[model samples]
Target: MSRLTLAGMALLLPGLTLGGEWSGYVEGQIRAFTQEPQFDEQGDSTFSLAFEPEYYQSWDRNQQSLTFTPFLRLDSQDEARTHFDIRELLWIYAGDRWELHAGVGKVFWGVTEALHLVDIINQTDLVENPDGEKKLGQPMLKLSFEQDWGTLDLFALPGFRQRTFPGEDGRLRSQPWVDTDLTTYESDREEQHLDFAVRWSHSLGDWDIGLAHFRGTSRDPSFNPVVNRDGDLVLAPHYEIIQQTSLDLQATKGDWLWKLEAIHRGGLDDPFNAATGGFEYTFVGVAETDIDIGMLSEYIYDDRGDDAPVPFENDLFIGLRFTANDVQSSELLTGLIKDLDSDALMFNLETNRRIGSSWKGALQARFWIDVPREDPMHAFSSDDYIEISLARYF
Candidate 1:
């Protein structure tokens, strides 16, 4: 075994010896593309396997705890995709109305389904997933306090992680692959710069609101196209300092959920405003059965218009979710995002169900429709694909 794997096992020894809680899953997935490979030597299909193991140890009558979660992935097509990550390795202390966390961890801070404009704590692991939901663990010191009016959270982040991208042999990337090794940072301190953020959240009656501010290097990076020695145009990631203010609100009434997220970012060429608002309505016990169905609609707007990096500017997203109240616990979610300015549309479907007590299966598919050359998604127009996975839990 590798030294890193041995070290991870050493970290888990305490929980195993002390009889603490342990859980995790092992999964294997296959992805099949509907179109021809975009680049030479790229396969139309790929396979990947991942294993995650978590251990938790508590002391002082559960007042203090330590959590260790290690993840590893192996890909059949790209050697760059074979990686290891410590998703969570933290020590947590909980007091009467306060909490302290130290170590590497993950924090999610957004409510929008289509895009997460405000969730910027950790660097994204883009090669792991296309939806930007997967994130690399961040090193930080966090403190939170609960008061009558609201809950306040303070974070001191110290480390920066570069985003991962597919290799030349990968089927999902553009013709010129991104070179993550040549990343550039505007700040002289580079990735070693210290970052901080604060958040305040409150719940009043049926409404839940959160306000946050971050001053540090932006998690999202801009690309600079440069010709390499091989005469190939490659994109290099560039990170810059940014100050962002974000607001997120949600209201729950009966079977309806209303959501809104807005953000204003400074330190760019021009400050911009972006927002998304949506609502979801659920029909419980559909047709007197044990199934529940939910309908979702959201509007996305960005002041940058055509200059925006994402195709979500002036877009509409509609989705449906189904849940089956059964022992197997089955769920399905499907959504579509349509651009109002151009003929760009993207559809996604995800479904998962339990095979037994310790096994589960999942299926996911994405379809691009009528993509226009002006749209940012045009590069991925031919990359529509389906993925299926089966996982075993321990």
Candidate 2:
């Protein structure tokens, strides 16, 4: 075994000795492409396997606890995708109205389904997934307080994690490869730059609201195209310092959910504003069959318009979700995002169901239609694909 694997195993010994609860899963997945490979050297299909294990230890009558979760993935097509990560390694102390967390952890801070404009705590692990839902663990010290009016959260992030990219031989990448190793940072401390953030959240009746501010190195990187000494084009990742203010609001009434997220970011060439608003209405116990279906609509707007780095700058997203209140706990979600001014559309379908007691299965598919040349997602126009996975849990 590699030294890193040995070290991870050694860390688990403490939890085992302390009689902590242990749980995890092993999964294998297959991805099949509907179109030809974008690059001749890349394959049209790929396979991957993952093993995730978690351990939790509690002390002082559950007042204090430690959680450890390690993830390992092996990919058949790209060596870069075959990697190991510590998703969560944290110590927590819960008091009467306060909580403290310290270590590597993950924090999610958005309510929008189409895009997460306000969530910026952890770095994106882009190579692991195409949807950008997976994230690398962040080193942080967090403190939270619960009061009558609202809940306040304070975070001190001491280290930064770089975004991972696909390898040269990997599929779903741009023509010019992104050299992640040769990255540039605006801060002299680089990944060691200290970041800070504060968030306040409150729930009033049927309304939930959150306000947050972040000041530190930006998680999003800008790519600079350059020619190497060998006259080959290359893209280098660049990080810069930035400040952002965010707001998230949600209102729940009956079987309807209304959500909104807005952000104002500075420290770039020009300060810009972005927002996403959506609502979901559900029909419960449809035909008295215990099946619920929901319809969703969302609008995303950005001040940069076509100059925005992401494809969702001026778009509308429509989606549907189905829930089967059955023994197997089956669920399905499908969505589509269409550009307002161009012939660009992206569709996604995700479904999952439980099997027996310890097994589960999931399927997902993504399709792109008439992606415009100016859009950032044009590179993935030919990468429409389907993925299916089966997991065994212990």
Candidate 3:
């Protein structure tokens, strides 16, 4: 378990005894590889069990509230994959025109479906998934004001979380493992560095717009090859302080949707700008059936171009989304990203359905093709795998 999770549980114990409501889910996951692992210590299959529970309470005519959420996962193969986190443990106060929030929470900021370029408030939980959808909760004190112009949110982030990486025995990694123990920080205070962010969001007719800025430690890290005390070559992570400005905009017109996320960041080797924009058109009641099909296309661009470390630079993303307007709530999404400057390609498919009143099932698959050695994804050339999971909710 994480130290934050433990501390949160201790602090929220009194709230739990205050007759709060509770809900949660437990799930088991199975991952099967399509090919042999690239490393000798890796395996072809892995299994894990995860649990996430939430507690919530409201008082004072619903103006004050408390929410506590904790997550845990135990992996059978990789020790680094077994971890815990405090997804949310917060207290909120809502008044007529202003609000206050204190504790650990998760915030999402983006409009693009393929890539979330403007989402930088919370660090990515890389061990959970390669898609970078999962995030770690951040310790924050936030104040918000709703005025005639828009909603303004001010955040004071106190603690920073390091990005998680796979272990030596884990899949989807290069030959040399990352030595997290050797992590370095640009700030003298390291993890104690204070971070801050502000955002303003408003809606106008069919358009929604949000602008935000943040300064502090960068969630993303750069790796330097070094020799550990054991005389083994490894990658040491180094965190840099950064300042970023971002924008997310979306327009909804009938069955068509347009989205964009853009960001300009400074504090690394050089300042760079990145953006992802796309459009989705949905065909309602396809073929006179209740199923709806949507076509998605997005363009990803980074000013650094081919030299960027991220794989999505100068790439195109094409996807299809299927929705079954049924009682079971079944949905499917399939997509592929192709590097415009090289042969690197990534194909992904994800689907989920409600099994029963209290059960759900999901499947996810990833494939990499034509990944050249120069590409960062070349390490995952043989890491294509499928994951299946079933969850029981209460």
Give all candidates' CA lDDT scores.
0.87, 0.89, 0.90
Candidate 2 vs 3: which has more TM-score: 3
Q: Write the per-residue lDDT of candidate 2 for residues 64-170, one digit (tens) a residue.
A: 78888988999999877888888888878899999998777899998889889999999989888878999988878899999998999999998888888876667
Worst 10 residues of 3 by lDDT: 8-17
How does residue 148 of candidate 2 score in lDDT? Answer: 99
Best by lDDT: 3
* Per-residue lDDT of candidate 3, residues 1-394 (tens digit): 2455645654664333466789999999999999998878999999999999999988777787888899999998889889998888888889999998888889888888999999988988888998999998888889999998999999999889888888888887766888788899999988889999999999999999999999999998988999999898999989999999999999999998999999999977799999999999999999999999999999999998878878888899999999999999999999999998998999999999999799999999999999989888888999999999999999
RMSD of 3: 2.1
lDDT of 1 at 37: 74
TM-score of 3: 0.96
Clash counts for the predictions, in order:
0, 0, 0
Give candidate 2 misplaced runs (Cα > 4 Å): 1-17, 227-232
| Root-mean-square deviation (CA) per prediction | 3.0, 3.0, 2.1
Q: What stretches of model 1 exceed 4 Å from their correct place?
A: 1-19, 229-231
